[model samples]
Target: MAMPVYNFGAGNPDPGSFPSQALAEATARVLEGAGETLVTYPDPKGHPPLREIAAERFKKNNGIDLPVDSIALTTGSMQAISLVCQAFLHPGDSIVTEEFSYSGSINCFRKFGVRMIGIPVDDEGMNVDALEEALKDLARRGEPLPKFIYTIATNQNPTGTMMPVSRREKLLSLAQSYGIPIVDDDCYADLLFGEPAPTSFYALDPDSVIYIGSFSKIMGPGMRLGFFAAKEETLAQVLYWKIDGGTNNFAAYVTAEYLKDHLWDHVREINGIVKGKLDTVVQQLDAQPDAFLGHSNPKGGLFIWVKLPEDVDPVRVLELATERNIRYGTGKAFDSQGRDVKYLRLAFGYASHRDFEEGLPLLADCVREARAITLEARV
Candidate 1:
């Protein structure tokens, strides 16, 4: 059977909505001035000016108050996570993360043979009680404590749950008490739709938390640009893992120029558009509350995690939806434990309202069909 071509699967920004004109102009200007620098082996620590600019932006917008000496540019935030994980974690060390986490980060930890402990989450974000219990259990057994608590603090991926201000403080305090570091993934923090987002975890525990940011969600994914802010000592350790020979100088230059010009403003514009798309999807989901249960009402982010009834098979629905020209990320791809079969990660940022409205009915129908099939198999 021919599959439908709807692509709610991708988490990337809409191509038509990217600031191509501004980026093109900035890239051209940088290239003209870059001369031999673009061709030569770049600085191993990344372009200095770019790092400085990123540090300034973080301080201004996120209240991070970081110095250029505390920042390191990497190919992407994914690379930054990998480097940090490699630098700090030993083979048997365990890392604590949310029950639902960014799959890529989980995979990276797996590569290093590091154990991962999935802490439960609630409306306030990661459940502090659950984490405390886990910590206590590990301590009692004389097991090695987690090296760090990695979290998507703002506009968390998949679930789109942002940790509230009080929760942030509590989480930081817990980490401090345990003497473990916290890796705050703030990549989606800028996409906030509410009045004002809470300050990052790094701002709260500047000395212990490593802040990771990226231009992929704000600018474009292909830009391959990200930066991290940490304590000078931790950042120095991260630099020791820089096997990229040097940083991607051209990307850094382009990002620096773009920020100096209008990148932040452009982000606000994209946020506004994405907000509307999210609202439309939410409204659609609301209209059929029985079919889609346990989903997030995201203030701002690229994805909506929908929990369908247990009888609905996401893989079968994905297959059927694809046949009707609609697609979404099946729960299997995001589930670290291979047990979340009733969930689906739907991205609305890439599709227009008209497309969503047109395709949603087909998606609903696909779900119904999957539910029916499951019932039949049970019978």
Candidate 2:
């Protein structure tokens, strides 16, 4: 029999942890209370109660005192981001993001025909100094400044690093000086294992920041609920592009009803499960340190970025692993420039415990073998 494929590529939440029963109950409650409203379309901005609940949660969690009207629900955070891009970007315009980021955003930026400048990132997330230097260089070269700085500062995707509030302050200061906007993507903010998230950029200066939040991480992505929040003036621009009539009204009602009562409790439960899965991947990687060079120690989020030996080509490692029925995301996908080939993002949340226990060792072995093969070729 063939060994089962272990997929560690997609940033999918654990299927086992999805609260099906709770959602079903919530769905029933919504129907009983407002079943008649289904005949009419929902508010274009979204269900008012859902927006109110999201605003309250943002205030409670991110320390942002946002009005409910400023919040616009979307199909997912991707759509929220798409709306922002549509509002601000024109062809030949410029934008900035971390050197390594979510591939989905990278693709979105490319689709707009805008120039994307990637700044170096460290453990604390985007290096603000590097960002400032890049901005200064653009000015020196007589180039236009980027329209906005887009950052996944909280539990950043792929790398799974969080930016400290100090860094956030510095970044905001730079944006202010340059007269640029900041798109703060906080989709993974609630997935932290235990550490408290830093103050968000929107909280630091709501006037200059566009905030994005989502239920895809703590809840299931299939629910398809996420939101965008900004000052009324800024939000008004993006709302023009959110022309999908309205996001799914039924999903909004059910999600809001469920999360209003059980949001934090559900967050804690999901974090516990994903954190344990992360521990498994770390433990396996730690056991064979010689096979790898370095890996990120993420406090929270769904991924661990592992860097391979210099000689070990990730393409080759992936090729070998694929033949063995294993799957993972390549670092190049997350890189806007497609130059990073030594890194792999292991998404532990989507895989089962048994998949990690069995597949991780096999993955380590593949790396060692790839490294040996690379060395032999170098000889």
lDDT of each: 0.80, 0.87
| Per-model root-mean-square deviation over C-alphas | 2.1, 1.4
lDDT, model 1: 0.80
User: What ranges in model 2 sit over 4 Å off?
Assistant: none
TM-score of each: 0.94, 0.96
lDDT of 2: 0.87
Question: Per-residue lDDT of 1-379 in model 1, one digit per residue for the tens?
Answer: 7643566777787667787787788899999958778878877668888787777667766665677777888888898999998899889889998877787887788888887888876655688778888998998999999999998877777787877888888888888988989999888766778756777888777898998988777777788888888888888888889887876888788778877767568777888889988888888887777677768877777988888987787778888887787878777666655465688888888888877777776788888899899999999
The best candidate by TM-score is 2
Name the weakest run of 10 consecutive residues (lDDT summed) in model 1: 332-341
Candidate 1: give the clashing pairs. Answer: 4-322, 4-323, 4-325, 5-325, 6-325
Deviating ranges (above 4 Å) for candidate 1: 1-4
C-alpha positional error of residue 157 in candidate 2 after TM-score superposition, expressed in Å: 1.5
Residue 317 lDDT in candidate 2: 86
